[model samples]
Target chain A: MIAKLRQVMLVLAVAGLAVAAYLTYVHYAGVHPACTAGQSCIKVQTSQWSRLAGVPVALIGLLGYAAIMGSLFAPEGEESRLATLGLTLVGFGFSAYLTFRELFSIHAICEWCVSSAVIMTLLLACALARYLLAGGPAPESHSSRYSTGSSGRMSA
Target chain B: MASRTQQKAQARAQRVAEERAQAQRARRQSRLRILAGVVALAATVVAVAVAISAGSASSAPKTTSVAAKHVSATVNRLLGGIPESGNTLGSPHAKVTLTEFGDLKCPICRAFALGPEATLISKDVRAGKVKIVYRSLCTATCGGPQPGAFSTQQAAAMAAGLQGRAWYYIELFYHLQGDENTSYVNPGFLDGLARLVGGLHYGKWLHDRSSPQLAAAVSSDQRSAHALGFSGTPSVLVQGPRGARTIPYLGNYQTYESAIKAVEG
Candidate 1:
């Protein structure tokens, strides 16, 4: 089960990275996707809220995906599993906040953002399951516990 | 020999334990890889969706330029017998007057010209339902000759007005505007425009443009605009028949449909 869970996390991390990369590309290129039906794209893109702080929102998304991918390579143990779970949770929370902003505040939905939000939600669930289902940690190595039995036999 | 056998058994057990741990690690790694792949796939799908939607959304609106029609013969006939010197576009009996203080070169004024001003002209001015006056405020920066620049442009416009084509000339200038403050008011450009409007007595008009009376009239209009608190072109004032109420310049009516409806009512 732990193995399966790891695979799910790995997949989500890579997927997130790809989404972030594309969004970053669009942000810097200033080439909006052709919008015919709704003229709101330019309005929304040009709005002050399109950038958070100084960085483009799309670039932020790319960095987030990269962080998630990096978390996946940590050594397998109770600590690593917990760390992964925490990171996924954070990703999910941030994605939700951005989604809310898009829906209510910005009033324009970036489809790529929505998809990332969905994937992040799934990733969070998978990470939590791994943490709960996997027994806490691998048994500790038995190096210091006992000397050779051959030395003890002569005394007996 | 018994000891050796026992040692061999322990060694085998240790090897099995190592194999189990290795298998577990490998399994975990594989699972993580699979999860990563799934996420990457989903992200790709999202990116594609965004690209597709954006592509369709921006390709719809098309703006075209149409040659403006000449004023109706009826309008020309209405202006023909009226005295050319004073405000005469609307009813003399009208108590409340609405005047449009505008610059021929201002873009916002140009938009107003294309928008509610057009509606107001058709419904109120042409129908004599409301008295309307146009006060041309050709200030230096707005549309007048800059201090250092050759101002043949304003001269040409004033000349056109002398030929009784002021409104036509203004509209043409707005329609064919170049970059602002770029010295676009050259003689050749003015000549071309005058020719387009037909029969502009350029020499006579140019001579009339700088007349002291015309300059005074322009100044008076500018003062009136300032008194009314209009610092911009395309400012309009609508007053009731009794001159009891006045509405100052508001912005585009696109988002204020209700206000427009009430005003029209």
Candidate 2:
């Protein structure tokens, strides 16, 4: 479970990082993301909410995904588990907030934003699962981090 | 006695399994507690990041480029170079004549002027693909209680065309257009626009604007538009070898370019 979960985290981190990176480049390049007519993609990207304190929201997302990816690469320990959990939680929460703003306040949806949000949510789930099953594998099952079937209390 | 000993061994194994299950539950609970604490702390930090970024992100940027709808450096670079005769743009002898029946104050027409028309003139028209002729439908079925100033604005643009700056004046007007039927197109505004066009004889434009011929020219354009059975302002007549046909309004500028392309063929 531990090994498989780390692979899952890595896959999610890379995917989220890709989307955020693309958006960040687009924001800096000042290019529209091929929004069709009557679509709110353009409106959302060009909205005031697109930027944060003179920095494009895309850049912020990129940095966040980068941090998550970095944490995933670190050694599996209490500290690393905590780091991954914290970063993924923050990303997930912020992504949810941005999604809400786009659907409500902006009244439009950027496909890129939606993609990023989905990736963040998935990463959060994976990170949380890893953090919960953080302990080393049982002596009985050397390949698995978690015990299967019936479990008994540890004496110590 | 053997059966009793076997029962005792079974009880010991069951007790060990129960203990292990309880310990696993405890570990799961402890992990959740730690996870909750981490989430809470991270949530606070994330909230602060959002709050700090709120200053720039809250209010939408007012000066958005409006979808590249305005004049670009490319457009400016190509201005005043095209040949103009009366209200026509591009080579006078160009094979295709793209006539736009537009009122200066019509908002839809304004969109055309700002978007597709801007691109068409700069790109297609400049390349001698089509000659765009701007006709003023100053009256007749425009349906609004257009102030007399509307006609004056049209005539003023016509008068500027006499100085070979007709397209220049029209471009400038759309660039600085005011709200419809607002009586905003006064003599002073037109004069300022002419001055802004640069190298256009503003004094001569003022003098020529009063000419009965220029005023009559505007009336003639309106009569021509009405004679064509045009249903409204902001209509187009594309005249090419395929024959002249009305370019049906699609309420967009992109279609305008396609219409021109179809006509040129």
Candidate 3:
């Protein structure tokens, strides 16, 4: 189950990495994002919130997704799981902030940004579930020390 | 023999209990480490987020009015000898015309105004080889159709044109362009820009800015921009006796210079 979960996480991280990489490319290449939503993408990309401090937000996202992927390849242990959780939590928080800025401050929604935010949200959820399942107490017998029953609650 | 068996069983039980205790201790330690790591990471994320938010706040354009006399002097120095009638600047009989579709609130348009447009005006427009036209396209703000303050400000420029000071007003507005999302195009800001235009008559300009004709002119600029299918601001269209061509993007003044030459031939 842990291996399967790791595979799932790897897939998500790769998807996120692709999105972030594309946005970063668009940023540095000085070309309009391939947007179908009538300049909202352009407006959001050009807004001040598009950058953090001096670094482009897209570059930050790219580095973040890359870090998550790196952590996944580390020795399989509780430490690696925790690292993934921590990184995704941060990404989720920042993605939420950017989404808020798009809706409220910029009054424009970039489809690419929304897609990235969705990917981050899913990654955060998967990381959290993986963390919980990994931290469950080891079973002592067939009955198990901890197991989820029909009620969806952990049982001893 | 039975007593010996009991003794060995007791020792085995003790050893098993000790092993379980050690395993539990290791698990507890690992959990603590993970918890500590999470807390530290969360702190760093919060710190970075706060820094980003502070940077964004500071990045908002400064709205405090610049010194009127200083702005007027600069505007005059740059646009002094040019003839501006309505939205057109340079000699009326100039063979070539370069029309710029721009939004006052657009940062990119502001860059063009400060860089290539400035050079084009000083060299070509001043020398009677070109006449530049200021047309409106709300690329960066105001969404669409509703116009809001974007149309109001564009209409204000058209009104300045009525007094033959459109270029002066356009240059000054771009000089003080603010955050696009901010409501900086109020009456005070518009009047402030107008005051910086050396010879603009405040009363007549104010009255004309609210006129229906100016409003239509602003709308007409939008229609023209749509007709040309311009998707962005500072979209330039160069025209001469040969033909008219719209610039695909804002590259540089040389792009405009070349296009003008192409049409001139």
Candidate 4:
């Protein structure tokens, strides 16, 4: 079940990365993100909130999804699981904030941004479930460190 | 009877071992929950902090009274000698025309106008190598008494053009640009801007701004902008002997400077 959860997370992360990459591309390319819903994408993209700390938000999303993908590949252990949880939680929180801004402040919605947010939320759920599930398999690389066997719990 | 007693004793020991293992598992699960909670709390704090920082950074700076006093003089100095016939600036015979599709309320357009644009006007435009044209496009306009504040504000600028001071009015507008969400562009605000344009006739501007010709001019700008597939403000294009080419994004003065050089060549 834990392995299957990771596989789901990987697929979701890849989807998120593609969305972020496309947004980042359009941002730098100075072209509108392909949008069917009127000018919402352009309105959101050109808004004050589209950037954070002078860095484009799309690029930030790209880097974040990339980091989450990196955590998935880390050796399966408490550290790797925690890393995934922490990263996804952060992404989820930030994406939520952006969505709020989109609805209230910017008054426009970019479909790509909403899609990324959904992916982050799912990744968060998968990470949390993986973290709490016990007695699956020992960390492949850190088996000796577990000491409590397949429970992967610290004896202390 | 002795064998029965041994079996009972073994059963009691087995129960005690199972209970101890269960208690250990419960303790481990509790610890995992606490660790996860801490990690989540910390991540939330970080995310909120970053979001707040971004919000504050992007907030518009209040245009101070002190700055307001010098805006007219500053704009006049920047563009005093430049020719401004209608919406165009610089020599009419200049070989290259750099057209900017902009909205006064758009912050990015304001940034480009105040930054690289000043340099371009003083150097290239003054040098008679390039003529800059302003075409109005409403990417950012707030609700006001006028149903179409975009057309009204732009028409006011076009009205200033009647006296050959549209560039001055435009430069001054960018300098005094406020929060896009605020409805600050009204008759009073428009009059204030027109008054700052050195020698513009206020009564003439008032009458001519509502004319059908200027309204048509603003409409034409929107049509051309839409035809170019531009949905954002400050979409720059360079026209020369070769043809028209769009600059993908606004960069520094160097970016526009380079494009002009390429077009001129």
Candidate 5:
């Protein structure tokens, strides 16, 4: 189940990465995305919120999705799972915030942005479930850290 | 076995069990600590994200609402006595129509507005030989890169056109134009132009600027400019006896007139 979950997350991260990478490329290329709400896509993508500290948010998103993919592929263990959890939670949270901006503040939607956000949200859920089902940490490592040497060797 | 030895063995076994239990408790506490730390980190990330967006939301300074205190007397004399209606600034029956595709922030457009445009308005425009139509080209300096305050300024001017004071607003904007790449184009600038131009209803212009109609109008003008294949601001398309065609530089009064006449001929 954990392997299946990781595969699901890996697939999702790639989808999100492709979307984000496309957005970032277009942003620099000065090509407007095909929009739904008239010029809303143009308006939102070109808005000030699109960049932070001179870095395109799309680039940030690209890196984020890539990080999630990396963490998912890392050798499964307590550290790896914890890192994935941290990164995806941040991704999910930031995605939610950006979606709010797109709908309310920007008053327009970018299909790419929305798709990435959805991917992030789903990835977060999958990650959380996988982490819980995997049950805390790798027992070998956890037990070693708290080993008192005199306890029953068969902890069960 | 001796009774003392049996008691000692039992005591040792009990001690080991207690040690294991204590270790279990410590592990649980450590897990909770890590969980708490992760939660705290997530909270910090969220707070930072919101702050960055909020800061951008208010990146522009508090809008100044100063009305224009210095209306150009010369601008008035030049535009005065001209037939103005809608976005057109000349006699309705003129044989030639000179369409200006411009960004208010474009220096070239400003030059044309302060130079050739003024001449055309005073000369052929007043004489009923030519009419000028002010169309926005946000595709250029104004809309280029990003649709910042310059785009909004264009929209505001278009909205003012709805009230038939577009010409007034256009001329005043050129006269008061600032650095093309700065925050000079803001609500205060709009307010100032409305006041300087004197006949436009400030409230209506403000309301109309962000309206759907203005968005459509601005987009239409820009799209038309794009369709025409003109790449920059202050581009002219002359329509006359020769039909409508984009023309080259209207360098001076003579060049400007010839560009129009050449199209008319």
Candidate 6:
């Protein structure tokens, strides 16, 4: 279960990275995401909220995906698993916020933002399922100095 | 007992090695994350800043005002004091007369009015070298005044003229002119505009604007403009002691300057 979850996360992380990269390129090149016919994509992109703290939101997404990929490299243990789950949850939350802003506040839908939101949602769901099914990291095979007395016993 | 001790020592060494590897991986990850984040942040900032600055630079109000001032100065120097007649204001005896037919509701007319024409008036009219006559042509086809509404606006203009405020009303109308023919020409809007030009007797102006004589004058002007090949709201004819010649008075100064010089020559 744990291995399957990791693989899903790895795929999602890669996909997110790719989407983020495209978004970043568009931001720098001043390209509007593809819009439905006759829609005002330029209006949406030029609006104030398209950026956060003076940074293009697309670049922020890129950094987020990179961070998630970095966490994936952590050793298979309780701490690493929790880190992955936590990072995925944060990404889900931020993506949801941006999606809401695009729909209600901006009144313009950006196709790229929607794609990122969808990917983040899938990642969150998979991460949560893996967390539940795996229970916790497999018990450590060898004892160490940090294992005090009987507490070091491998329960699994 | 000795074998057990040796085994414990080897396990400790292995644990230390794993810890060291973990720490190295963590350091590398942290550095990579920081580098990626900084680059991403810088790129995003640069992109956003460039977009915003470009948008603002084109439409900046200050730049527009500065351009307006320069145009005003040039026109004032070139065409000052031609005469004043009815709605037309300029030096009465100036040998060279530049008659401009314009629609208040036309954007292009407004541009010419507020830009090059303003400069011409100050320079030629003030200096008594050239005369400028403005004949209102109600060409508000899309969003300007209706036929009746233009008569009212013209009447209001005539009333303002009676009060020695023709130029003032013309200026105010140019400044506050609304969309052509759209409901922007309603009585309320006109009233507000009249008040801005100092209240002309609305009743009298309304009556005089429909007068046969004013109608005839407007019709005659329209015929003259059409005969001179004017297809648009702003058709200018520069007539001097030299003779009357059509001048291309587009928005830019180069064409306008050449036309003025040609008329002067």
Using TM-score as the measure, which candidate wins? 3
TM-score of chain A of each: 0.76, 0.83, 0.89, 0.86, 0.84, 0.79
Ranking of predictions according to DockQ? 3, 2, 4, 5, 1, 6
The most accurate candidate by lDDT is 3
Model 3: how far residue A25 lies from native, Å: 3.0
Worst 10 residues of 5 chain B by lDDT: B60-69
Local lDDT at B188 for model 6: 61
Candidate 1 vs candidate 2, lDDT winner: 2
The chain B TM-scores of all candidates, as shown, are 0.55, 0.67, 0.75, 0.74, 0.69, 0.62
lDDT tens string, model 2, B1-265?
4488657755775786687777878877787788789988988987986787555444322212442234423335657578878788998777788899877765546546756677778787888878989888753214444457666888888888888778777776665554442455666667776766556777788899889887787788878887888755567887887667686342344565566666665
Please write out the lDDT profile of model 1 over residues A25-125, one tens digit for every residue.
65554434344524234324433344554366667667766776676787787667766765666567657655765665445676667778898888889
lDDT of 1 by residue, B145-193 (tens): 3532323344455556666676555556655554333455555555555
Docking class of 3: incorrect
True contacts kept of each: 0.00, 0.41, 0.26, 0.10, 0.26, 0.00
Q: Under CAPRI classification, how is model 4 graded?
A: incorrect
Better of 4 and 6 by DockQ: 4
Query: Against the hidden reference, what TM-scores do the models get?
Result: 0.41, 0.47, 0.66, 0.66, 0.52, 0.44
Q: What are the runs in model 5 whose C-alpha is more than 4 Å off?
A: A36-38, A136-156, B1-25, B61-187, B190-265
Residues B1-265, candidate 4: write the lDDT tens digits.
4488657755765686577567668868776787668676857676675667565545443333566659878987888787779989999999999999988887668767866788899899999999999998877773322337888889899899889989888888888875566676778778888877789999999999998998899889989988988777778988888677786445567778778877785
TM-score of 3: 0.66
Q: What tens-digit string does per-residue lDDT give for candidate 3 at A1-156? A: 888988998998999999999999877655567889866786787666787875889999999999999999998887798888898888988898889889987788999999999999998888888887887777665234222331243243
Instruction: Find the number of clashing residue pairs for candidate 1.
Output: 29
Residue range with the least summed lDDT across 10 consecutive positions in model 2 chain B: B59-68
For candidate 3, the per-residue lDDT at A85 reads: 86
